[model samples]
Target: MPSTWTTTPVTAGLVHGALELEHTANGILPHRLPARARAQNTDGQLAMAESQPSGVRLVFRTRATAVELDTLPTKRIYVGAPPRPDGLYDLLVDGHPAGQAVATGGNTLTIDMSTGTVEHGTGPVATLRFTGLSGEDKTVEIWLPHNETTELVALRTDAPVEPAPASGRRTWLHHGSSISHGSDAASPTGTWPARAAALGGVDLVNLGFGGSALLDPFVARAIRDTPADLISVKIGINLVNADLMRLRAFAPAVHGFLDTVRDGHPTTPLLVVSPILCPLHEDTPGPTAYDFSHLAEGRLLFTATGDPEERAAGKLTLGVIRDELRRIVTRRAADDPNLHQLDGRDLYGEPDHAELPLPDRLHPDAATHRRIGERFAAHAFTAGGPFGDGTG
Candidate 1:
């Protein structure tokens, strides 16, 4: 006997962790930022990063033994660098890792890092199929690639799939830089925030955008509007990465962003996290540049360009940002007891770095991501922690 297949239309209920869905010519495009927030910005990097679907997944319940999905992914290419591997899709059955696959032959975006120019190339859709699932009724989750911009074209399985029921867990909203956006992580669930969410027994809404976690007002508004029991903002890195602002503007910008978030979530458990240890930017200011000197060796690294003496002129550095964040949190916590601060070093400090040094002198590797996620779970979800209720 042959197996029968059923096609399911992708809807909002089936998509988790994305703020909005866009109807495209081929299929649906998931957007991390809502339409209003996306419309208010003109930065191409932000647009690309948000559409990458860092924490987005297609979740449902089914008894299907075989599943197939059609997607058109916009793969990224960097000029004068080694080609990047295809983005990976992680499959989880009944909350455990089951299988993984990658879709090929989609769109392409060729970028020139030095000149800031992007060229687009269109390609054909790719179908990803996964077979050999248990036939018993179980929940299924297809985690989209954390670093690829994918347009879901279709979903087909041997059996019907319906929206999975609520897990009765608290919702956690996290925002951060590329590290939190799953940069260099092996898969979508391998991102620190995703792993931490699982260990903490919470649902996650990740707004981690690569190279775009600056304290932007629109992002604050997006967080203000989203509903979450626990909220955290990982700050400091992108600021130094872009060398976007000075100390005079940085303080006020931080305050304003938090003020906006408080407008809607006054009593939410808010955690402000400083940057993790990045030796190059710990003391030196950035406008971080690629160390193309190793390009011939098929490796790319980052180096700090701004002088350390510029700190005296109020240029921002990781150390300076951490001190300022502590002061701001202490003063604010005096009145708002719900507000808290966590040092990023506690999550990935000097010792951890020494043991598992960053591969590119910037972003942590997959192993380091797991370590950071485990440490974060221990710190934030355990007893006596901000969001914890003094119980495991």
Candidate 2:
């Protein structure tokens, strides 16, 4: 710890990236969804993703040379996998990537899907520290691990830390699946949404929930209530993978989702993006299943297990979802000029996929993330684009 440093509580007002904070006896746990919104959540997948804090960060102003955070992370471990990687904490000074960290100790949750059981292992909290910060008062953003569930205990700094002044940048609120949550991105800033936020010159509030982007009403409510100059929803991928709804339920669901968001952000630029090219699920319906064929080789893969014929019964594939989304957006745009649609393939298509195939047969690699972010900024935010100021 820095000599004679002051400590600060991890309060709701201090955290920028998280939607809500779960104040516990040990520390404050950041939640991507608020209590009212989370109350409707029953799916374990959504529950897990909400607690991961992908784009959530702690933003404050400080002149400290050194800072430390006591955190207890709930790290998940699959029963058969060798071991998961440590979650990273990416730090930014005045919006520039500066440092990175990883907490050491916390409770470990092990799960064996084959047995449908979970084992919780308790451990001590670990303090992550960073030093040599520039002396000038500067805005600092501590991006939490995108893949880990972290409980922030306390913050210590050589100098007092206060909420960072708003950048006065337009807030871009984005919602998507795992790709948007940064499944394979190198760091928090490396995520496509973060990269796009940088390129688009906007503030980011990423609501990208991994497997939870199933067009849930609560998610739509959250998006509707949040203040955003520009709003985007990267739909379809999670829908196809989860096979949560069929054609009949999907169209109405999409309509309802957008309607709910429009209730609050009637005029905000809303971009509805389809799924990126995932050949595995383009034609095949899914409830994507794990392919442990080469477990010994330490290579895990996923496959769409649902039959293509199921589409006739209203089962959704990426292609089906994309077509439906386009139809819905075009129809809606006829009435609402603020609504727009962007094909996900434009960001990551055939050529890009060949060079940077989704390493997991799902999530794009880190480099691919950069490509997506850059493309998104060009397609959505640049002049003459859907979200360009000229549109208004």
Candidate 3:
């Protein structure tokens, strides 16, 4: 029989010292901004709506000599979809499947979901019990549905803990599309943001979302709200690919996004980056392949272009976007001293392209990710650089 653990209530803004993660089949996607949808009507008014929840698993890495669940709620682990008959939350310890928690009674872990109990379902709430684990590093993997979302309310551990000491290192908050999110990178840590953070000896809050990095006011609001010593926003590819707005609207939208972020970080060094070279979208931009053949499966599938057919008729390539971004920043810098711009080609260009071909011709492969990280560290983080003085 498994040991029984106490249950605790989860409150908003509760800082759980535990390192929380959501499970993704490909890898872990960071839970940063809330997901939303955007569409404009004939009247040119934009509409926004809440997006459906996706499945995510929570993985935790720990160095506890011993482990136990001090607080296990009886509430059902709410998955977004209808009750899955065979769905089970599998808990793996140290890479071994330790046990399974079955979904039952409306998938609630506690009795009478109305009361918000922690113990629900057919099994005990505390399904995991560990011993002789002191001083040993262990990985706990929880595989959950990507469509189903869950909030980590709280965590309690029995290990000796010490807070991280305050360091003089600066914080770098970066906002970008999938690339910034570490998409298609070989490993989570290998993502360019992570690599650059390590190389620059700074803390990072990566707000990169795959296919969801369109310039949204809410996202800019989130960036403005986050505390950081340095910041950068990478734009362009998503704009051109989605073709959501024309040149007239694109420039203003970028300016508005920056203005909102600046409301909170007026003096912080801000670097605006353009897109890298993509042959498919360069110059001629109609109907480029969005979804490459999932090599895991042998089939070629394509997704719709975000850019409109008319605008894409004479597609603005990555090169064109780089030049425009440089010009925009240069002109804006005349007034905003702390604002700077970076050409994506500076990180990866035709020469780098000849040597390392991106698997999808969109996102960079692992090798290119490393090269980008190294170059970004050299240019953006070095002493006396644009981002070094915390000034524009």
Candidate 4:
């Protein structure tokens, strides 16, 4: 069992921050031992298996004594996952050092704070110790490990947090692709969603998942079941990039997703957002890639193109989808006054593109994340705005 110690002076003030953890395959040991008895199979050897680690657990505590948390039933947690592990690992608050006992021979490590035992396995788990916390109107954050591939499995507070104040402040629930999920963002709180939530003074529920926001029914169902005062769905770019759906099916799927949410939040303010400007997909659809071979030659080139017929068919541009969404929402707004629409480009456009080119032309950079967050907060949460009514 691992030992614990209380670090220095006991500060009485509240500790309002996040606890986070991230996972990847960068430092994992191989499962099978090297073979010395048989010759290596050099010919047509399969490439190294992709090291995608999942099922990570994180636990932590808060020190907010003056705030009554039972009113806020749920707390928001942020997660980040990059494709490759280039010496990158997730950040853990008060985590034990990695070792054979803590990490074993596998990548997955389990930290059971309740028992002070840290061990390695195929699965990972971390526990948060919320021992001495009492407060009123306080917010605590649990930041996931940074710069790693991990998913948030569950969240529960030591005590149920009170719901948002009935008379003041608004809550914003925004959903989008990996960009909103902190892809390429510097930190969990630095993600645009978190940034926007802070700037708007609203509670955030970041449902952004890396490469997982494909208008999935499960996602929409999760949103439907969740309670929110304001909500927005950012769509298009991911669908186009993944080639997830063609025109015939995309529109209906989006409508159905929204329809399910509306059944639960009939009068709540909801916004449908289209994609920002992505030049590669603006005129040409794509399976985009960067030419890394030129790195040694002191040059970098990016290559991206999609099915010529698909481009010609006008099937994958953000403009096309935005038009469809606008029409859909406009038609629905005839009876639903709370429904609204916003074009993503309005927040980040070609003009801004000159200054903030996306790192991979898919996810925004850190600076752009800030800019996008500010723009979103200003538009969606200001007084007299669609979401300002506070009807949740």
Candidate 5:
């Protein structure tokens, strides 16, 4: 029997997040930032992560057993370095994990960082299909890759598709580093934020950028302007890793970031979380160094190279940043009762580390992402937590 296929435009209404959408020559590129936010900085790290579609997902409804999506992903490759991991798209049917896929068609951007050179080549587009659905009207969610930039081309289903109705759940707007960006996670939906959203029953807008979460003013403004019932900002690591600021500058920057967000969400429940335990960086300062010794073996790892003595000279460390953040939130909460703080250690601490070690000496593994997400839900989204309902 022949079936009619309906094509959907992949518009903003069908997407859960992405601060802005760019109409690329081939398709629509979902950006984690708006034009104004994007215009402020032209840094390479920001550009890459902003377009990775970390927390972005395609959500819709249809009574079709089969569906297809076309995408043009811009996968990055570093010359003479470990191969880049493939981007994954996780599909959920009626809120349950149903399938997974990777886009095959796209262009490749190669960079020779050792010499500061680059090249680009075109590739074919990929058509991802999902079948065996029950044909009853159902909600479908396709989570895009968190590490690769993708341009959505088209969405086709056996039956007509429409924007899924809002789930009526509270909106959770979260910002953090790569770990929160789903780094090293097996699938997009397996990212900690995605898992937490599932457990908390909230709509998620992830602004997690791999190495770009340095307290940028533009990022604060983006968060300021976004509408969210609950908000969280995972601070520390990036600043330390980049060696961007000193203890003197860190405090004011933290205040400024919070100030920008408070400008818009004055009364919304806001949570500030510090960095989890990273043994190598606990007391050591960083402009961390890459452990390239295993690069030839097709493995990548990171290590701290900064001196621990630098702390006396105002260098920042995860340990120092954590204490400062807790102090900042506590002082602010004195007057603003809605403000709160959570020790990220509680999510991925020494005990958890004993059982599940960090593979890269940084980002959590798939199982840890799940454990952290579940812990976050219990601590921050369950009854009596900051995002808790009024009943508790």
Candidate 6:
């Protein structure tokens, strides 16, 4: 006779790195942003990004030889773009990579990038099973897909389970754009922020919303209220690509954001990172658009549509944003010693770009993600760095 499976309720205590949990019709959906912050905005992009659960995971301890998870994933589909693979669920045992699985059935979110139109199609839940595990008590983590919105339906194991005890690691809360949201990275743990967190021996709370990190007031408030031992904000790329603010508005907005974060965490080690090297937007302004030129070939690429000549008029570009960010951090750091600034180029600069270019002319590929993660760990977590040892 087969061993009877024990079903466990997925609850808040069993989940890690999520700020909120919403009870859906089928199951629980983890959210990176709290309900209050989400209530303030109605942008579809932000909504989808937050629901994706970039750095969220299920954590427990058990002696089960086999484990199973039932999930309903809302997969994204671009009408004309190449087909995307099914979302991945990564399993870790005792802090080591154990296995990886993909849930089969789920809803589909069809997006027409050209017209900014979206359509939804419903599907059934998928049960992902992993067997052959060691039957000794050990910590287990099931990292949710970084790019897909997943509703965790149920968890089943051959043995009873309990929430894993705290690891006592420092919590690092990070906010950034799609790149930090694991846009092109292979898995949730593969995101640069995730990789860096692992290398730095810290817990991660990622607030990286794709194409939506516009320094919104609600986001700042969300950051302000969240508890974190270390904090970092990656700004500039989205601001430039979205063409959201001018130089005059940009400086004040950044200051206000930092001010909001400091409201809750006055002495936290906070690092302000500029955008990494993006040659397309380095000199040219944006309102980036899809290059439909190769649509016939099933290739979708992004291109800057803003006129380079608009720089004189104060249209934002990567170059312009970087300069202003350095100046702002310099002046602010004089009065606030805990605050620090790092050039985005230092992470993935001109030399790094020549080696590993962004796949879509905007987002970095998986290899570049690793490189950026390694470099970030070296910079921010080492001695003399903002979040380094001996720093408050």
Best by lDDT: 1
Using all chains and alpha carbons, the TM-scores for the candidates as numbered come to: 0.98, 0.97, 0.64, 0.63, 0.97, 0.98
Q: TM-score of the candidate numbered 3? A: 0.64
lDDT of 1 by residue, 286-366 (tens): 999999999999999999999999999999999999999999999999999999999999999999989999989999999
**How far off is residue 14 in model 6, in Å?**
0.7
List the lowest-lDDT window of 10 residues for candidate 6.
383-392
Candidate 5 lDDT, 141-166, residue by residue in tens: 89999888998999988888899998
In candidate 5, stretches whose alpha carbon ends up further than 4 angstroms from where it belongs are 1-3, 390-392
Distance from true position, residue 232, model 4, in Å? Answer: 0.8
The true-versus-predicted C-alpha distance at residue 103 of model 2, in Å, is: 0.6
Q: Spell out the clash pairs found in candidate 5.
A: 105-124
- Which pairs of residues collide in model 2? none
Q: lDDT score of model 3?
A: 0.56
Judging by lDDT, tell me the better candidate of 3 and 5: 5
Give per-residue CA lDDT, model 4, range 1-392, as digits (tens): 11333222111121111112222232211111122201232311110110111111222343332111110011111111112322122222223221111111213433342344545444334333333334333444334322343332233443433322232545566667667666666555667777777667765666555555577665576577666788889988777766767778877998899998898888999988888877767766655555455555554444556755675565666767788889989999999999988889988999999989976666788798888988887777777666654432
| lDDT of candidate 3 over 1-392, digit per residue (tens) | 21432333222222111122344332232245433322222211111101111112334555544334321222324222223233345455654556554332222442232343344353222333344543565665443321222333334445533322344668788878667766555544456876787678775666665555578887787788778888999997776666556566767878899999999999899999888776667664434443534533542233445343454443455655676778889998999898988888888888998998676667787788888888998899877776665432
lDDT of 1 at 75: 96
Angstrom error of the Cα, residue 221, model 1: value is: 0.4
Q: What lDDT tens digits, residue by residue, belong to model 6 across residues 306-337?
A: 98899999999999999999999999999999
Those runs of model 2 whose alpha carbons end farther than 4 Å from true positions after fitting are 390-392
Cα displacement (angstroms), candidate 6, residue 206, comes to 0.6
Residue 212 error, candidate 1, Å: 0.6
**Backbone collisions counted per model:** 0, 0, 32, 37, 1, 0
